[model samples]
Target: MDYAGLDYRNIRFPVDRPLTESERAARYKQESYSNASPMDFLSVIKLNSNSIDLVDRWYPIKGFNTWFGICVVLVSMGALAGIYSALFFSNRTAPIETVDWIGVSALTPLFLLLTLGGWWLIRTECGRFTHYPMRLSRKTRQVHFFRQNGTVLTVPWDSLFLTLGESKSPLSGTTYDLRAHVLDDDDETVRDSFSLGYPSPLGNAESIDKFWAFLQPYMEAEDGVEKTWHHLKENTGYLVPVDNRREGWRWSIARSFMLGAHWPYLQLLFSPFLGLNALGRMLAMSTSKIPQWPADVERESQPEVNDPYVLTWRDNGSLGWWELYWPLICTVVGVGAFVGVIAWVVSGLWR
Candidate 1:
């Protein structure tokens, strides 16, 4: 994996190739079983004579409509306004009755809470999706974080640490979050951190290891004593998680759908907002079947061999036919349902 000459930023580097009998035997001897699959690495890695740059970006998943977020906000606000108008400002000709007053009083607080909650959710989504990407530079030995508002924070390479955080859900099993943190001058003070939260399925430790392996080589090359090596050794793994029974695109999509369905049942009443989020994720995962691996990972201990199966960006297209179908269906259904709801509400108001 000599990534020195490869332009990882614009290219889709192939992380797997057909192994020869000798190679397979060698790998089997090294590890009895292989847990890692042929995965794709979407991030960009640029190498220079004196430095390397890695950029992990948040890309809109294929089959997931980004515009759905806008639709969700608009429909929610519209519904809120409609409800308020219906409850609080009904026709003057129809004298305000005791029951009407009671209804208004009861529903007003609920409406207000829903309005505030919707706004907060919209803001959170915008922050998560539209924020700047994470950039790491080896030349300067610094990691630069760009905020949504164009602000940048730079942290020294030596100060950086990888933290693994876990969350358990009774319905969806356990999910892990990989976070990058920077410690302050005293090394005891924590300055800043960011996370690529729950990037893969449960038990897929290889994804986390691959992400860390990208930074490990550069970090180790730095001129001072490394404090994070122990952390690295602890987190890194040789075996990938495997299940032969559940394989291929169909199984992957089913697993993703089940995971996405983990939203609390109580939240179903707020389907307009929560449903869109889940639907977007489901579509994205279903359409993108290939797993992604980190590019330019240093394998210093392995023998050098030219790989003939390497793939370039030009060889790949944006989305395949099957991948495009589900997203199109989701878009049509989402739009149709949205329009029908609006029409029904407007008709009820007229009545």
Candidate 2:
């Protein structure tokens, strides 16, 4: 799925017709599925009785993967150069041997794989907008999509042609994302399209349906949001870990390590790579622009002064600063210990 949604490189489905039920199950009955809760993802910006804003295609893992790609490309090139130097520059009668040629040939495919894979990751992630927010207003019954060009596309909530964005690749396999198609007049031509939320695992239609089910009530319910909803109740009100808010250094570092398992030992094992991943995210976010809503959309989206369903990062919740920053603390201690070990080794050598 094109989370940024600006680039139209390929059009797999026919644009002139509505997506068939068989094509993507567009008419799939919307319902909540296990692990389909909004809290599982970190794309929401704000949620209130009046409206909700979400970061389009905001996947936290992408930042780490982008830096990983750079490392792959660099390491592959360095290995290739080292092999070439040792084979040709060694003081010998023959500059290169048959054994060296065989070694080089054996390593060629692995080198290409690393170089190409890394380049693909960097190409997809770098030089993109920090985020594009989409606002769904219950009061106005409109969906506002923020574009990279500082323009907002406003369309009625019910008018959008919704479908699943499914793509296959040899490297990453199959992935899915929720897509909303903007139809031209006469409702036959898909003029443009954009994705919502983050991508999901292959064939996880249940997740897609459940996510849509969550949005349906938010946009259509006559009453306020369900009190039982975790995001509406258990949320920490800390703005999402996106660049939209000015997060502190500790929070930024902590958020990156909050991936996958929660065990302390596992966290310690992965801290070094996680630290580099966090730096990559910070760099990417710094280079991109923060999206700003238009005056008209802003005015329309304002919540009631006494809005009871309003939720923001500022609202105090169960989590505290210590819990949020523990990952960064552990990472720092680990690095210090590593440095100490190196210093002790150097001292022994000098003695």
TM-score of each: 0.50, 0.69
**Residue-wise lDDT of candidate 1 within 54-116, one digit each (tens)?**
333233221123335445456556666776677657666776688877876776676666666
Candidate 1 Cα deviation (angstroms), residue 157: 1.6
lDDT of 2 at 15: 57
Best by lDDT: 2
Off by over 4 Å in 1: 1-41, 45-95, 125-129, 167-174, 196-206, 218-318, 323-326, 337-351
How far does residue 22 in candidate 2 sit from its true spot (Å)? 2.3
- Model 2 steric clash total: 2
Per candidate, the number of residue pairs that clash is 3, 2
Per residue, candidate 2 scores C-alpha lDDT tens digits across 9-122 of 442334566555554545422232224554325556677767888766644454665667777887788677767666776565865767878889999788988899888766
Candidate 2: regions farther than 4 A off? 1-18, 28-40, 80-120, 148-151, 164-174, 185-189, 199-203, 225-231, 235-238, 241-243, 246-248, 261-275, 316-326, 329-351
**Candidate 1 clash figure, as a count:** 3
